[model samples]
Target: MKLHGYFRSSAAYRVRIALNLKGVPYEHATVHLLKGEHRTEAWRARHPQGRVPALETDEGAFLIQSPAILEWIEERWPRPPLLPEDALERARVRAVCAIVACDIHPLNNLATLGWLKERLGADQAAVDAWYAHWITEGFAAIERLLAPGPYAFGETPGMADLHIVPQVFNARRFSVPLEAFPRIRAVDEACAAHPAFAAAAPENQPDAA
Candidate 1:
């Protein structure tokens, strides 16, 4: 398997953590998003969406989108499971993941920030404000939802951890104050101590600037 990704992408970062936790061995292929490599026609042919973190499986199947790719990773590598066995517990965990993946991440992603700058004439201060507003709103809900634990849902990191850790990275990147979200910061600290999360960090990746 070969994982195509950009070092700083939160979506790509989640998949890296997932694979490491699952103990799956795969090659890493860097797609230089900053250089517009993903926008080239050749890359578009391989991945219609031209996004990072596309997993090329051993069977040569390409998996796109971090959420779907994450689900597939869990299904493909079930041991040390990222989800709980109980149905309701799974939903609760997934809801935490959604808070980051659905509500927070999309609004602050590169394209959205780029559009804010180029299309809407948003200056740095305005862009940072927009980024912090969404993060504060979504993280408040996540803080309430988080379990009193070393991870988002329980003693061990799971799907929720995979999602939140990356967003926390993004939060710090934008200078968003996390003092209001102690639970979220605690989870970040806890995850930092774990090897899987450590190895998947942006600065630890091959292509990190």
Candidate 2:
């Protein structure tokens, strides 16, 4: 399997964590988002939206969208499950993951930021402010929903924990203040220390150019 992704992309980061947690060995294909490689005709043919994390499965199927890719991973390899067995618990975890992926992440994606700069003439300071604002708001809700212990759900770093960690990584990159979100910070720190999470980090990726 080949995973097409940018090292710094949060969406790709989630997939990386999922792959590592599942102990899936796959070759990394670097798509340099900063260089606008994702928008190229070749990449667009594979992924209509020209996004990172278009996973070519071992069976030769292309899976796009981080959430869909994550669900696919969990379903294909059920051992050490990333989701809960109960439907209600699964829904709760999915809710938290969706909040970050659908609502907060889309608003802060590269295309959205670029549109703000190119179309709206948003200055660097304003753009940075916009990014941090969403991070703060998102973290506030996440902190509330998170359990008091290290990981978001409990001892294991499940789906919600995986999604939360990457968003916090982005939050720190954009200089969002995190002191207010102690619970969120605790869970992030714990996950960062785990081998799977550590190995899948952006800086640790081989193609972090």
TM-score of each: 0.98, 0.98
Question: Which stretches in model 1 have alpha-carbon errors above 4 Å?
Answer: none
Backbone-clash count (model 2): 0
Top model number, lDDT: 1
In model 1, which residue pairs have backbone atoms overlapping below 3 Å? none
Q: Write the per-residue lDDT of candidate 2 for residues 1-209, one digit (tens) a residue.
A: 99999899999999999999999998999999988999999999999999988899988999999999999999999989998889988898888898899889999999999999999999999999999988888878887887657788888899998899999999998889999999988999999899999999999999876
Q: What is the C-alpha RMSD of each candidate to the true structure, in Å?
A: 0.8, 0.8
> What's the lDDT for all of these models?
0.93, 0.91
lDDT score of residue 80 within candidate 1 = 94
* Tens-digit per-residue lDDT, 46-87, candidate 1: 999777879999998999999999999999889999999999
Which residue ranges in model 2 land beyond 4 Å of their true spot? none
